[model samples]
Target: MIRPMRLVSIEQILQARKLLEGVTRKTPMEHASDLRSLHGGPVYLKCENLQRTGSFKIRGAYTRIHGLSEEERARGVVAASAGNHAQGVALASSLLGAKSTVFMPERAPLPKLAATKGYGADVHLHGAVLEETLAEAIAFGERTGAVFIHPFDHEDIIAGQGTVGLEILEQVPDVETILVATGGGGLVGGVAAAVKATRPGVRVVGVQAQDAAAYPASLAAGKPIRLKEMHTMADGIAVGEPGKVSYAHVADLVDEVVTVTEESLSRAVLLCLERRKLVVEPAGAAVVAALMQHPGAFTPPIVAILSGGNVDPLLLLQIIQRGMTDGGRYLKLRLRVPDRPGSLVAVLSRVSSMGVNVIDVEHSRISGALAIGEVDISLALETRGPEHCEEVARALQAAGYTVV
Candidate 1:
């Protein structure tokens, strides 16, 4: 039988805030004019992306580790994470003079792995996914007598993460709706508890990646349900299940939980990069994605948390390209032209005349379906938007070129 869940209290969160003083940064809140324009109300970003260890994980990690008795501290701490939590635990343990052991997935990003180790943790690579890695870490903790530092689920962790909610309320007193990126529900649950206990009027929404969302089903069942498989580029929020403590808080306190598509996530990342000059990871951009995809779904004076900024550079490049394509700023086309030198020039000139920038061009005469006297040309063009892309395609077709 499942034990009754104990919800984190606002008083506990306040105590956690006192413990976190001088240990964590009060990350800034910035106005998002572009999101405001789309939302038709004031919008702001809680920039936890700039927090210590590059995420709010530090708040919970430090608070939890600090609560341990002296004897437990001497035993050290062990944790499992793919990225953010590992760095948070490593640094938190180091600051508190405890040895930390962190187990990460085999395919965890190189930058995150390096950062975790740099924070003085004994790093171990295990398993193909987070679940397997977590198993190994737990076993290690049990065998070595080290304290198992859970990334979420514990009341202390929830209380610690609740500090973000306190900071948000203090920063934006009149904020109506607050959107938070959700994975295992720790952050959202803590925020909801704090906000509800204090204001009792603010609406709190949790945003999850659609492909890996487990909260909706779990909430429907009124229990934490484990997913057999999960996949999403927003790896930070790709948890397979919610912890019981977090589930209790979410079910009781949060106003709503919503999911955003991968395409919208990419577009949100692009918007933060190009428009706001902020480097937000896909998970961190979930709130922005929700606002952009559903314009009127939220209330005015919204505060969206930018959960983390730890992203692989290679993945960033791919997301940017995908974002451009999804936003209709990039267009790819194949056309049939005469097998002559002027054919390429003619197409380029026609494209340039319409103010479209040609990113790449490929000409091939060898194709299974190409006629004897014809060549197939592939073009990668950039345009202003969807309308411009359509105009460019139509103009090419009208210029007597077969847009294959």
Candidate 2:
């Protein structure tokens, strides 16, 4: 049976805010005109991605570490994370004069590994996944008498994260709806508690990557349920299960929990980068993804919390390319053309005539489907948009080119 967990109160969150004074930044709320246009209402982004340590994890980490007794601090702290939480714990421990040891997945991003170490944590690369890394961290804490700082389970941590909700109320006084990117449910739970306590009528929603979402199933069952397998580009919110404490808060306070597709996430990240000039990670863009996927679902004056900005550059490049492809701005096609000398030039000429820019071209005559005198021409083209992509394909076909 699942153990009962007490919900975090607004008073506790207020106390946490006082404790975090000068420790965590009240991250800015930026109005998103582009998203506002889509929803036909005011849309704002709670830019926790711009917070210290590049995420909201610092708030909870500092609050949890600072609450530790002197004797507990002397014993040190241990944590496991793929990235954001590791840096938060490392920095919080350093600030609180406590030694911190962090265990990260073996395949964790290089930037996250470097950032965690940079924050004065003794980092250990362990396990192929976060679950294994968490086990190792717990065992280390158990054997060494060090306190294990959970990423998002404890009451203190939830209270600290709840401070963001308080700030949102102050920043957007008339806000009607709030969307939070959720992993183990800490941020969403905390925000829900704080928001519901003050403005009982305001709606609080939790957004998760569809592939790694656990809350939908868990909430339906009235308990936390562990996922057997998870996959998503938003590794930050790719939690396999909901924590008991967070689950309790979410069940009681949040109005709804929604999931967004990977395509929507990529588009949201690209949109933020292109329009808002913000570098948000996949998990951070989950709220925006929800807005894009279900345009009219959210109420007006919506605030979507951008939870972090710690994505790898390589991954960012791939996500941007995927976003472009999904948005129909990029098109890839193969064509069967005569193996004559001017065949390649003819194809390029036809494509260029249509105002399409070729990003890449591959010419080969060794395809199994190609006849003796035919060559396969693979073309990667950049177009204006979805309509332009279709027009390009139609133009090629109209020009007597067999688009394979």
Candidate 3:
């Protein structure tokens, strides 16, 4: 339960903005040409992915560390994170001339782990998941007399994140709606407070991965509730529970919260790469996912916050591969053909005739599904898109080849 206290005020946010003037970059708000006419209004993207440490995490991390009393600062700091916050706290503590330790899950991506260590944190790989890692970090903090930098639950963190909201208002003075990617709600809550305080007429919508959403339930219950399960490709925003401090702000100020599927996240990431030439992580692309899945719901003059860009390279490759499949450019099909020698050649010829590139082909006659005189061929092909996939499918079927 959140303790009753005065909420973070505009004065505090403004003060944070002033403090961060030189510490953080005022990230760009680029107009999204592809979405300009959405709802007959212009759309823009708040590109926080390009921020320091490849995420908005640094803003809060820096603020929280900087706010520590001089005596407290002498004791150092400790934090736990899946990736982005680890890097943020590590980098921020380094910048402040403070000793820092970060606990990360054993399964945390290599690039993030390397980057966090690179930023001067004494990194520990301690647990199988973030929650377990977090517990260890807190224990370490208590053991060593170090300050625990709560990732998204502290007032200072919220205040620092609110600076992004201020930047958005200034960058797009006439913006009508702001769509933010939410995890523990730090970024969105801070943004909502700043945006709604100054411009209550503007809509602030929060988007979360459907597989790990907690905000909707928390809001409905009027308190933070821990989810029983959490899973998603967007690991950055996959918090299973909403933060008490941030949740209060989000529940009161955010206009609505929505969720998007894993497929939408991949498509959104692909769209960002293909159209905007920006490399956004799945969590950062949650705003785009919501827009793609629910374009009609938003009024234009909008800005979608691309919250981070710390995606692991392997995950990115997988998302791209999956995105291609989802977009109908890649296909996998299994079919039974006569066991005769010419059968494989015939299928390859038909596929080639339609200008489809065969990525791989496998045939087996020993499968349970195959008849005595027939072999099953599984083909992975690359086509132009949905229309071309259909054309290829029709051509193969027309050639008396059964596509299963």
Off by over 4 Å in 2: 1-4, 367-374
**lDDT of model number 1:** 0.94
What are the lDDT scores of the predictions, listed in order? 0.94, 0.95, 0.91
Colliding residue pairs in candidate 3: none
How close is every model to the real structure, measured as TM-score?
Answer: 0.97, 0.95, 0.94
Q: Residue-wise lDDT of candidate 1 within 1-404, one digit each (tens)? A: 24566789999999999999899999999999888877789999999999999999999999999999999999999999999999999999999999999999999999999999999999999999999999999999999999998898889999999999999999999999999999988999899989999899999999999999999999898788898888789999999999888888888899999999999999999999999888999999998999998898999899999999999999999999999999999999999999987989989999999999999999898999998899999999999989999999999999899995
lDDT of 3 by residue, 29-82 (tens): 888888765457788999999999999999999989999998888999999999
Superpose all Cα atoms of candidate 3 onto the true structure and report the RMSD in Å to 1 decimal: 2.0
- Candidate 1 vs candidate 2: which has greater TM-score? 1
> Candidate 2, overall lDDT?
0.95
> How many Å off is the CA of 401 in candidate 3?
2.7
After TM-score superposition, what is the CA distance of residue 325 in candidate 3 from its true location, in Å? 1.9
Off by over 4 Å in 1: 1-4, 367-372
Error of 3 at 327 (Å): 2.3
